[model samples]
Structure formats: C-alpha cells, structure tokens
Target: MLTHPMPDPIAFQIGPLAVHWYGLMYMLAFILFLVVGRIRLKQAHIAAAGWRYADLEDMLFYGVLGVVLGGRLGEVLFYHPMYYAHNPLEIFAVWKGGMSFHGGFLGVLLALFLWSKKAKRNVLDVYDLIAPLVPLGYACGRIGNFINAELWGRVADPSLPWAMIWPNVDQLPRHPSPIYQALVDGVLAFILLWIYARKARPRLAVGAMYVLMYGCARFFTEYFREPDWVVNVLGWDISAGQVLSIPMILFGIGALYFSYKFDKKAAPTNVAKPKQKHAQ
Candidate 1:
C-alpha cells in the first residue's frame, strides 16, 4: 500500500534556465561510471593491461555522445516512428524526455568501437573493461524515469504489498516497475557481472554476459512494466522491449559460445593475464 512519490521533475530553476532531476540523474550515472572506471583502472590485473585514467575520460566523452544521440533516435524510430514523423523537430527536443535503453546500448557499442580503434585496443577487451560498471549507472537512469513518473508499470493487484498508485496514471495499484528494474537489472546485474568480470575468462565473455544478463532482466521485467508499444508476432502479443532483447540474447549466446569454443586462451582465473598492449 505505497503511493508513488511523484517528485517534481525540475530540480531547480536558474533565471530562464532550469535544472532537472533527470539531467542530474544522468550526470550521476556518468559520474558513477568515471568513479567505477577509476577503480577498475587501479585493479592490479586491469592496471597491468595498461588502462589509464585519461583513457577512461576520453571514453566517457564518446559514451555521452552515444547515449544522448542513440537514446533519442531509438525512442523516435523504435517506439513512435509515426508520431515523430509528424513532429520531426520534437526528435531533437530531448529535454522533453524520450530515450531508449536499447538505443543507448547500441550507441555505447559504437562509441566503444571508435574508442578501441583510436586507442588501438581490442574492442572486446574494452567492452569487458566497461561492462561491469554499467549496471549501477543504469539503476540511476531508472530512478530518473521513476522521478519523472514516466514508464510507469502495468496494473497490479491491490492486495500485493508494495503495490503503488501512480496518481498521474490512475487510482489502480501498479507495480513500481522502475524500482524493480533498478534492483534486478541494475544492482543485481552489477553484482553478478562484477564477480564474473573480476577474473578475465575469455575475450568476449564478459561483454556477452552483460548482454545476456540485461536481456534476461529486461524480458522478465517487461511483464510487469507497461509496454510502450507492442507487436503481434505469430498471434503472440510481444512487447517492443522483448522484441529488441531477443536479438541481444542470441548475440550474447553466440558471442559466449565463440569466446569459449574458438578462443584457446579461455580459462577461469583469479588473476587476469594482460593481453597484448596496443599502441595508444
């Protein structure tokens, strides 16, 4: 029997310039990434691989671009293409809020690829380095979503403990799906991935594990969260999030299989061995 906090989306106003909690949450997410990345840089095994703090800053720059652009575009193209087609200029009005995690994920991949090339490092290696650090930041983003009262969950049984009523939506109790996602997809995933990524096993395994875990989490959570859109496939009312996650699940499985089966170096260890140091 909990009520949604429905806090003001705007954090503060500064003479015609307003600061928002959503923006602050994103800032926090980036800050967390840098902080965790710094810790990763200091890890004995990771440090031996020639990871530097400056490199992380450079990657962060690329990541910001990727998240903003990719998330906006994904929202437009995947969720509401027709709407955006009519209101084309609204696509750039990111401050009004619309972003897709899948899009941001793809954006990060592209950003990582570009960073890997410029840093002359193996792309998979870079992915492995950053994968574990992502979940906590994701949790923050979900918190932002909750604060904005956007992406509210589907209807829920009133009898259920912790069932919440989002005043913006309706009087019916609904699952606090954002919190669920933050816990399962963000915190829990972080714990699992952090442990998995601790000692390197294979080239693509860590990154693949991230994809697999997130895909599974999102798929499971979609049942509770309200679908932004749905498509009927073979008479199945599948969610857009679920549809996007299917390919990720497949790719994760494929990448993991490839990592272990093809890469002779694949092995469990307490201390990760350094790969060939690429020119920076």
Candidate 2:
C-alpha cells in the first residue's frame, strides 16, 4: 500500500496572486493542443484541407471559453444544482474548484460548430481534426485532479500493488483512479484515436471513434472511482458517469454506421500519397 504525496496545490506565487498546479496543468493542456495541432496540420491530408495556424489559434480561443464555462456549469448543474441554487455567488468562485468533462465536451462541440460555420467547413470535418488532440489534454486534467487530490478512488484490496491511501479520505487502501483515468482514458485513448486518424476514413468515422473510445474508457474507469451519484435504471444501479457515457456509446456506433453505410462518398482517399521522384 502506498500513501498519496498530497503535494501543495499552489505551484508558485507572483506577489499576492498564488498560482495553482491545476491552473498550470490547464495551461500545459492548451500548449499541448497547439503543439499537437501543429503536428496534425503537417499531415498531407490535413495540409491539403486548408487548415492553417490561424484557424487552430482561433479554435483554441473559442474552445477555452467553452471548456471553462461549460465545465463549471456542468459541475454546478449536474452535481450540485440545489447547493448552487442556495449559494449562487459561489458558482463564480471557480478558483475554489469544480468542473465536468461531459459539460466541457458539449461546450467544445458548440464552440467548434460556431468555428466551423465561420470557417465554412463541415462540422464533422472539424470534429475529426480536433478529436485526436483532446485525450492527452484530458490526461493532463486528470493529473491536475490527482495533484489536487480531489477525485480519489474507491477502496481497494490491501494486497493490491499500487493501492493508495489518501489520508484526507481514510486509511483504507484505494485505487489511484485519477492516474488510471489519465493513463487509460487519456493516454491510451489518445493513442488509439491518433492512430485511427492517421489515415482518413469515412467523413464522420474519426470523430465517432473518439466518442466510442472515450465513452468506453470513461465507463470502465468509473467502476474504479467512487460514484458521484447513482441512478437507478430499470432496477439496475449505475453511476452518473456511466449513464452519461451510454448515450455517447450509442451515438458513436450510430454515427459510425452512418458514416460507412450512407456516406460512401466520404470514404478514405489517396490524398496522402507520397510524392515520387522522377527517373534520374
């Protein structure tokens, strides 16, 4: 059994302003988005599609707004609507900490939609381009969660290797679920999605793959983590996260079917063909 390090949340301070590791993690996530987006743009198909650094920058700006606003609102509304209703002013105190990935996901979709409209690009195309870049950023957020020691996992067997005890919670050994999520949901998902997106598939396939991968990953990880809330679905108990993921899974499957079945024109192309040298 291991004990959580419980590092200080504040990384450093400038004058009266104390900077939190969570904030730094977010900054790192954004930086990674730009860095990875640049690499993604270098792919022949992406370059041929007219994506530029300007568009990536613009999208990041809008995405930031969506993530902050949507994640906060989701935390308040989904988890503690009544509490927030009673203490409305506290909602603005995001520094105190609260966020939701599902809400952020929705927010990003809306932000990307607006960007697509402005850029005169199909929404699915935008989604495909951005999907592969998200998981690593998500992994960063989970690391932030671990650093803050907010979302501790459920109790685990004492014999389990790497089982951790969050002194703040209890003495019982628990799964280090945030790390599990960072590695599985964030890192592993990114790997799979990045590989799949390397070559073009049907128009919506790449985005759908992300939805499916994340939905499955989140559903799996939720089992290890403590439940935020439980919902009774047709006499079966399930976590709120699992409930939310179900729809994403269904959407992914449905969209994948539609992409391959109906949208045949959107199939993979040889747009990424390598340039050949002329006979010497």
Candidate 3:
C-alpha cells in the first residue's frame, strides 16, 4: 500500500511575508543565474567588440516578464482553458500555482529575440550565452512542484521498491515525476548546455542544441507526467508535449548542421590592438 509524504510548503515567515519553499527555490535559482551570468560576461568572446554585461542585466529583466506572463497564460490556455474562461480572475492567481514550461519557453524565446534585435547582436549568440543559465531554474521549479506535491506521475505496480504515494494526490502510489524532471530536464540539460555553449562558434548550434535537448527530455518524461485536467490527445491520442517537440527537433538538427559546417573554427580571443594607420 502506498502513502503520502506531505511536505511543508512554507519554509518560514518573516513578519507578514509567508516564505514558501517553492518561492525560496525561485530566489536561489535567480541568484545562481546572476552569479553565472556575471562569470559569462568575463569570457573572451563576450568581452570582445559589442557584447557587454549590461546586456545581461537588461535581458534578465525582460526574461522575467516573459516567463511569468507567458507561463501563466500558457497554463490557463493550454491546460484549463474552459475553467479559466469561466473564472477569468483565477488567471492572475499565480501564487496559487499553475505555470507551464512550454509557455515560459515561448516567452523566453520572444524576449531573447527582442533583446537581440535591439542590441544588434547575433540572436543565437545571446541564446548560447543564456542557455546554460536556464536549466537550474527549471530544476528549482520542479523542486517547488515536489514541495507542493503537484504533478504526480502515473501509478506504480504494487511492491514497486521506489514507488511513493503523494499525500496531495489522494495518497496514490504515483511516480515522483518532479525528481525525474529535476534530473533530466534540470540537471542533465544544464550540464549539456554548460559544456557546449563555451565553444567558439556561431551561437545557433548551442541554442538549437538547447531546444532539441530540452524537447527530447521533456517529451520522453511527459509519458510519466500526469496529463493536465483538460488537455491531451492531438489527432492520434498523444501528449501535447510530444506534439510541440517535433518542430523543435527538426530546427535543432538544422542548426547543429550549420554550426558545424560554417562556424567550426575556434573563436578568437578578445585582446585588442590599437589601429596603426599608414601616414600619407
């Protein structure tokens, strides 16, 4: 028989501010991004010509807006369109929880595109730079899910050694999907991006790699993840994540091919030499 381990969502409280573990995870994620991003700014390629740390600061601000708004809207539309439409006010209750990764991803993509355009940067360069910084935040979100005991996975067979019953899900022996996601989507993806992005190349490759890797990981994991209350099945009884991932895989393959073909040469260091003009 399975049982629930109900975790305390609230970590602590400071006066009137109720500090939740999920919120604390978010704070830690942000701090990690700041630390990593600053280090990235000092890299040779970033220090050269036009890229600057200020760009990173600007990007963080815009990215937050994109993630929060896009994630919330995605959850409302993709998962519970009917419920939210009927009770629209519930859409803004983000603190109550319900954000989608796909939505947040789209939001981040759009935000990066806009930032690249404004700064006159190779869009992929910005993407490659930020890719490594993303996964930890995602992992943190999964931790939050675990703390809240939401998004439990499918039932396990009786006598399954690792099976657990989440108290939040009526104490059913469901898979710990958050932990799985934390490993593959959060930790593994971070390692891949962190290793690949440092290469000296046109940035499209890494950006595409990030998308492809994330799509593959998420698509595979969705099998274990429970479907949204009002979502699933497209034409042939498949998950929404699988449907969304197909195009990403294609794009990733294309980008990787091109990066290898055109930008294989190692990127040069940023050391500068003063102009020595010919005296006429």
In the range 1-280, model 2's lDDT, one tens digit per residue, is 8999999988999999999999888889999999999999998888988999988899999999998899889988877899999999999877556778988999999999999999899999999899999999999988999998878898999999999999889999999999999999999999999998987678889999999999999999999998889998799888978988999999999999899887865745566988999998
- For model 2, the superposed segments whose C-alpha errors exceed 4 Å read 266-280
Candidate 1: C-alpha lDDT = 0.90
What are the Cα lDDT values of the candidates?
0.90, 0.90, 0.79
Clashing pairs in 2: none
Count of residue pairs whose backbone atoms collide, per candidate:
0, 0, 0
Per-residue lDDT tens digits of candidate 1, residues 1-280? 8999888888999999999888898999999999999987877778888988998899999999999999988998889999999999999877656789999999999998999999999998899889988999899989988998888899999999999999999999999999999999999999999888777568888999999999999999999999988989899988988999999999999999999987867754478788998899
Clashes in model 3: which pairs? none
Model 1, which residues run further than 4 Å from truth?
267-280
> Number of the top candidate by lDDT?
2
Error of 2 at 7 (Å): 1.5
Encode model 3's per-residue lDDT on 1-280: one tens digit a residue: 5455666778887899887887777777777778888877777766673566688788988888888888888888778799999999999877666778889988989988998898888777888888878899999888888878888888877587778887666656777788889899899999878877665556577778888898888878877877664244464555666666677778888878887677745345475878999999
